[model samples]
Target chain A: MTDVLSGLEAGFAVALLPLNLALVMGGCFVGTLIGALPGIGPINGVAILLPIAYGLGLPPESALILLAGIYYGAEYGGRISSILLNVPGDAGAVMTTLDGNPMAKRGEAGRALSLSAVASFCGGTAAVILMTLFGPLLASFAVKFNPSNYVALMVFAFASLASLVGKNPIKTLLGAVIGLMLATIGIDANTGVARYDFGVPDLLAGIDFLVVVIGLFGMAELIHLVEQQVTGKFTILPIGKSFVSMADLMATKWTILRSSLIGFFIGVLPGTGASVASAVAYGTEKRLASDGDTFGTGNPKGLAAPEAANNAAAGGAMVPMLTLGIPGSGTTAILLGALLLFNVTPGPMMFQTRPEIAWGLIASMYIGNVALLVINLPLVGLFARMLTIPQRYLIPLIAVLAFIGVYSVVGNPFDLFMIIGLGIFGWVLRKLHFSLAPIILGFVLGGLFEDNLRRALSISGGDWSILVADANSLVLYTLALLVVAVPLVLSRRKRMALDTEA
Target chain B: MADRIFSGLLLLVSIGYGVMAFTVIKAPFQYDPLGPESWPRILSVVSALCCLGLLARPDTERLDLTGKTSTRLVVLLVLLAAYAALFEPLGFVIATLLFCAVLARILGATMGHAMIFGVATGILGFGVGAMILELNLPAGPLRALM
Candidate 1:
């Protein structure tokens, strides 16, 4: 407890630096704007801004603070579009639209917006408090993991992702394999041999993670925005007075608390994100809340549950990323990649070696959540107005940013074309209903996966059984097996039940 | 249809990658029993099997990219390619101006609006990149003026 407090003190010392504070506020503002934009999510926002963060040459902690601010701020901002436009700004906000749009239709858009903001604040702040307590404990535990244990952990991560993230496990697994393949490009670090360089000079170093991120998320998102423009799905509903009554907050207080806890726990699980958290929280609330019947028709509890849950989940997702070096969600995966880019590997040792980065990020998140609540409540009117920004302008801005972002960071002209190729490939994959998260998680984890496996094998003198020889690894393997098998069995049983009912 | 084709292509890629891992990749000395080729080999095999799974369970998802949307995507691709190709030579300002203007025009902005937005973004973006961020974006022919 003293350690956490002292660490937080040191963290505040760093986080309260003028520059860091500005970055947190700036990132939250930008994040909210990005989140408020239709058809963009936290992943896209982070990916788009990552290069700029890199190009700015900010110190690692400040950069992370900025990015982290954007992350949860998007959680706050996603509700804006959900409430006003009836279009989810991000995946996590989908549940928000159910009651949010209904509230908008009923001319209580203001009440919905303000209520969601308060719920998000409650969720985000509660999750941060939980993270502050649990993060160090988790890291201390994870510090004991051996190489083989890490391999099993990686497997568990992959299995969880494949089973939990998307509809088809095959596609998720395949996407991961593809990501691993991408990681295998360029010279082998262990041996001085090039594996899949294709005789290209640029391929010698492998594809940069920034390039992949910008291409897959940023550029592809631009293409998707263009598609949305073509489809003509853009519309905005008029918002009335923007304030939440005290009664509404009191009525939904329990719902917010329950959803926040649910969201945080779900967020802590590797491979799950805000989307799952909000969905689960919404589902649980519908069963437990008093006005369950009005869930889809503008119940304040319905809006509060998802909003609170998603923000808490966003905070929850950070615990694993900062502790185990395993990201809990797609956005966290990108953040992990960012940490790697800064040459600061996130793991158990991070607290000891780079406590400033760890605790400073935590402190900044604390400030950022408050900043988001303070900024979002009143400025929501302005953020909701962002939906009116024509895609023609927004599209070019994003496209230009992608191009400039890549060129500036890498300074390699070749990466420009590479991003385009990757963008097209990513767009195709998205069209095929494959989740992009696993690919990134796989890519980020690929190096660690190969390194640990090789080290374990070396230690065992080529004996493969050493991978499961230890209790930790065995437990991890069992968990991995359970993660993979349970979902398949349950889905099959559901199908069977459906067949019988039919 | 798209799923099958993509998976088939993926299968080919895996096979090709595996063959290269076996035939082309070589280590001069081995400190460990498993060499560099082993991990790639394992990855390729897993990838091949996954590709097979995808091929077997070809999803019925369809992409409706016909009409003006498809044309815009293609044109945007070309513009992006041009932007990249001209980035270093034409400089960030010139390349961005042209690309942004054309892309804005394609996306339905008036010609005047496109040009104004393009020029503003180019100059402002250059200022932000070179002056603010201190990025090494090529100045090209605009070097003398700056």
Candidate 2:
């Protein structure tokens, strides 16, 4: 109890610093704008910012403060276009607009936007408090772990992520293994021998993370854009009311609490992400509504539930990130990497070594959430007006920001090339049925897997038995096996059923 | 080959890696014998087997490739490679401007409009990165101002 209070106190003190607050505000504002735009999402946005952060030399805590705002605020910002434009920014915001846009079309846009704001705050605030309470307990347990178990833990992480997505499991594994292989490129850290650099002088330093991120997300996305010759023009938004009335709030109080609980729990689970949380929340609300038939048709309660759930989930997803160092989504994965750059190793030790960062970040989130609600309500009119801007001018400026941000941080010409390369690749991946989540899961966990495997082996004199001998390690390993085989079992049963049908 | 694409990619990569893993003679140990490469390899092999299983009974969920999308992808890749090659020689502001402008045009922006954006982006980018972020951009001919 004392520990929790002290951490909270420390978080507040550290977060109050002027530099950190500026970063939090800047990140939130920028993140909201990007999220409001069509075709750009959080992963690409974060990847684009990576080089800038590296080049700027911002303190890790401040950097994280900014990135966290970008993440959570983007989760909040998607509600803008989703409510008015009838276009979902990402897969997650698809639900918010079902009724949100209809209400907008009916001139109840202000009411819908206001409900979204309050619901987002309720969900965001509740989850942040829950994270503050539970995250430390998880971290404390993680701190006691032996290095041998980290290998098993990494395996468990990969297996759980691999099981959830709906693609050919084999191909996903291939991409993940390739990521692991890429991570091992350059000189072998243990033996001091180069493994895969192919001996180029520059290659000796290993493949750069900036290079990989830009290539995967930036260049990939560009490719898709060029192929389609994409053109999206924004319409000017008329000023609308932005406050939810007292009567509406009183009517929806119970619905908000129920969905917030549902959203937070699901959000904490790895691989669930915001899309699922919103979908489940909508379904639950629809089932639980008294006059449920009006959903998808301009009802205020319709817009509120999914909006609340997704925001709530955004806050809840931080649990795995802060406590276990296992990120739940692409945005959180980027946040995890940013933390690593700060030398803030997550898990149990994070709370012990950098309670200021752990709690300060949590405290900043509390402040950041309030800032979003206050900032977004009045500003929504101005932002919605941005929809009227001409595309030629806006896209070029966005592109310029990306190039400048990338080049400055990496200080390598190659980094810009990588960004363009990956942007195009990302574009193609989006066009195809492939999910970027699996690839990221593969890439992030790849390093942890290899490092632990080598570390575990060196301890046990090359005998593999140590993996099974450790009790905790064994349980995690069993979980990994079950995760892999369960899908196979279900698929086989489905195949047999199909055969009978034939 | 289609079935083997996933399985074969894995099997082939694994063989190459397994052979390569031996180059370290003694194969240094960590706290255990697995070291850094062990678990990655174990996963590689297991996932490879899963691919093999899928290949043996290939399901017909074929992905259709559009010519324009594939062509766009190739163009994007080539353009980036070119940008990397020209970076040091062209310098920061010039290279980034040209790259951004060229990319915007290729991604479907009109040339005049694209160039205007490209130039604005290049200047503002250098300003923000250099002045505000305090990140050092390549100086080259711009060094006199510096």
Candidate 3:
């Protein structure tokens, strides 16, 4: 307990510096604007600003503070569009639209918005407290993990991702395989031989993960927006009042608390992000509600459940990345990339070697959550107005931003061509209903997975049985199999039940 | 179905990749028992198996692109390629200005509006890149003025 308190004290000393405070404020403001926009989400927001953050030459803690601020702030901002325009700002906000827009139509926009802010704060604070108490314990446990255990852990992450990411497990697995193949490009680390570089000089350096991320999330999204050309504009509703009544708060306090707990645990699992958490939380709340039939209508509990859950999930997703060196979501994957750029490896040793970056990020999240609530309750009107920006302007601006971001990183034109190629490929994959998150997660994990596998084999003198020789490895392998098997079984049971009903 | 054809092609590619992986030359002095080729070969095999599974259960979902949409997509792609080629020669400002203007027009903007927006974005992009971030963007023909 004393160690955690001292670590937090050191963290506060770093995060409370004037420069860090400014960065936190700037990140939250920019994140809110980006999140409030219709198509520009947290992923795009982070990718577009990543190079800029590097250019600023801020310290690692400050940079992460900024990026982390953008992450949670976007969660707060995504609800604006969902409540006001009935258009979800991002995938995680899709559930919010079920009851949020109806509440707005009934002239309770302010009530819905305020309740969401309060619920978000409650969820974020609860998750942060959990993180403070448990994050160190998890890291200490993971510190004892060896190469064989890491290999099994990576396999478990992959299995969980492939089985749970999308509706089609085969497609998700294919995407992951493609990602792994991409990771094998360029020179092999163990041997000095190039694997798949077709004699091109640029291929010798390998594909930049940032280049792939910008292409898939930023450029592909632009092309999709142009393809849809959705011109249906929404009228802005008036903000009648900006605070939820006492009765309103009392009614949904239990619902918010329940969903926050559910969301945080799910978020700690790799590959399960805010969208899944929010979906499951909202469904659970509906099932447990006294008036379950009022869920899809304008129930205040309906709006609060998803809003609270997603924010809590965003906080919970940090645990795996901070402790296990594996990203829990796409947004966290980019943050992990940022950590690598700062020469900080995120894993068990992070707390021992660099307590400032670990605990500072945790401390700043607490400050940032309060900052978001304080900022969101008042300026939400201004943020919501950002949705009125025309698509013609937004699309071109996003294209240029993506181009500039990718170009500035390597200062090579080949990366530009690579991004465009990846962009087209991503679009095609999206059209086929394949999720992009698994591909990215696979890419990020590919090098680590191979390294651990090879290290384990080398240590065991080429004995493949080392993978399952130990108790930890055996348990992890069993868990991996169960992760894949249970989902298939559950889905099959559901299908059979539907058939029987028919 | 389209998915079946795609999966079949993928299976062939995976097989080709696996075949090529076996051809990697070994170093004069090996560090470990398993060389660099093992992992790639393993991945290729996994990919081939996945492709075979996909081919067996190909999805029937298809995306139908209208002629106009397809043309617009092709034009945008070609323009992007052209912009990349011209980035160094024409400079960041001129090339980006042209790319943004054309892209805006393609997405349904008036000529006047597109040009105005494109020029503003180009100047602002250059300003942020070169002035604020201190990045050495190509000044192209506008080098002397700055």
Candidate 4:
């Protein structure tokens, strides 16, 4: 109870600032607009906004608050497009359309849209409240993480993230290695020397997070979509179809709460991110629903679970990053980069020295989430109109925006080339049934892992015993071994079976 | 194109990364506690093994890039390369629209769609880039004028 009151109090105090409030409102609105746009997502949107946020002279907390608003706002907004059009604006919304678009097609678009909007509100709100209450407690624990403990923590995150998808461990590791390589492209932070710049001046600064993300999410997707225009059979719903009903809301309430909690827990795990949370939540809900008959065919619970989980996951994912300085996803890593750029390391020190920054961000999550719910629910009708735009025109707009968004950041077209290159690569990776989330997690966490490894070694004077010298390290290492070994053993059995058949 | 070539390329990349990792300055350890070079080097070796694994095992999901589709992606990639290289020289608006229009055309958009896309995208991109995102888009010839 004290923790709850303190969290609420801290949140209210930090969030009550007029500038912070305005930033939250503006960020959410932009996030919704970006989400409403076909093909762009919160990651791309936040990434695109990074340069502007830095340029605007906003403090770190304000910028973080704004980014959070946009992040959650995008998650909520994505369902609108997914339901109205058969297209998912981002991967997180992919499951949403399994049920969301069908209801839209059945002239229940408004009901589907509103149900999602409200369910998202409940999930997002519930998670943010939990985040507000527990984030500080977690931060206190995180503050005490020694260098060795952090190294162990990161290792656990990497292994767990790799294991999230049941099949394709090799592919996961390959993608992860590639991501880590990308993470290492710039200068070596410790040595202040360039590692893999390959004499390119642009690479000396390292591949900008925005560059990789925009290219990874935006321009590349454009290329792949064009290449695979095998889908001329998509349907569109007329604007203003009433998909929402009080009944739909009631049916999804339990699913929303359950998914929200699940998403929050998943979010807290390093590298788990929203996609895993949503997929797991959807999978769980499918198994749990007695009316499994209704799911994936316009069931409100189907849309509600994943939508809620993904949004709640977005809120929940922030816990580890702010507390431990270890980002859960690529987007948060980019946010971490931004925080570092602002001279604020997001570890326990942040809580001690900058309570406003820490508490304020927590507080803004509450305000931002509520603001998003209110904004997206009423404006669902308008955002749904986005689906009516002819694909002929739509693809071009996305392509152009993608190119421009990539180009404006760092003002180099080589980055643009890399985006297209990575896009093509991403498209191929997607087709292989390999998930991209692990690769991103590996990329974002790679340097943190390396930096900590180096630090621990330096402290121990290159001794091999320091990692095992502590209880925390022992626990983390044990977890990592269990994750790596058990999965390998289990999956090897399946692989052998497949091999025998082959 | 993806089967044999991608594997070979990945193998080369892994070897190259391994060589780079081996050259990194780290104290050599006899046993367990891995150094900075350990993970990267291990990744390089493992990645190379994975590449070989791909070679030994055929890709069941064969990537079918037709000559036309191959030409489309390859040309699109090259055009992107050139587009990025000339962005500031041609002005962001012109370069971006041309890039989008060409991409749309190659992707099977009709001329009407391409033109509408080019114009609307240029205008909208300029608005968002300059006004909203606040990122500087080089106006090329308009550079001095602006």
Top lDDT hit = 1
Ordered from best to worst DockQ, the candidate numbers read 1, 3, 2, 4
**Each model's lDDT:** 0.91, 0.71, 0.85, 0.75
Model 3, stretches more than 4 Å misplaced?
A235-238, A499-502
Writing each residue's lDDT as its tens digit, candidate 4 over B6-94 gives 66788898888889888963543333254546567766887788778766763535676688777766776787777777787888778
Interface DockQ per candidate: 0.77, 0.45, 0.65, 0.37
Model 3 agreement with the true structure over B62-93: per-residue lDDT tens digits: 77789988887888789889988998888889
| Per-residue alpha-carbon lDDT of candidate 3 for residues A152-173, written as tens digits (9 for 90 to 100) | 8988888888877787788888
lDDT of candidate 4 at residue B142, scale 0 to 100: 51
**TM-scores of all predicted structures:** 0.98, 0.88, 0.97, 0.88
lDDT of 1 at A470: 90
What DockQ does predicted model 3 obtain?
A: 0.65
Looking at model 1, residue A180 earns an lDDT score of 91
Of 2 and 3, the candidate ahead on DockQ is: 3
Q: Is candidate 3 or candidate 4 better by TM-score?
A: 3
Interface RMSD for candidate number 2? 3.9
Ranked by lDDT, top first: 1, 3, 4, 2
lDDT at A197 for candidate 3?
88
**The 10-residue segment with the lowest total lDDT in model 1 chain A:** A226-235
TM-score of 1: 0.98
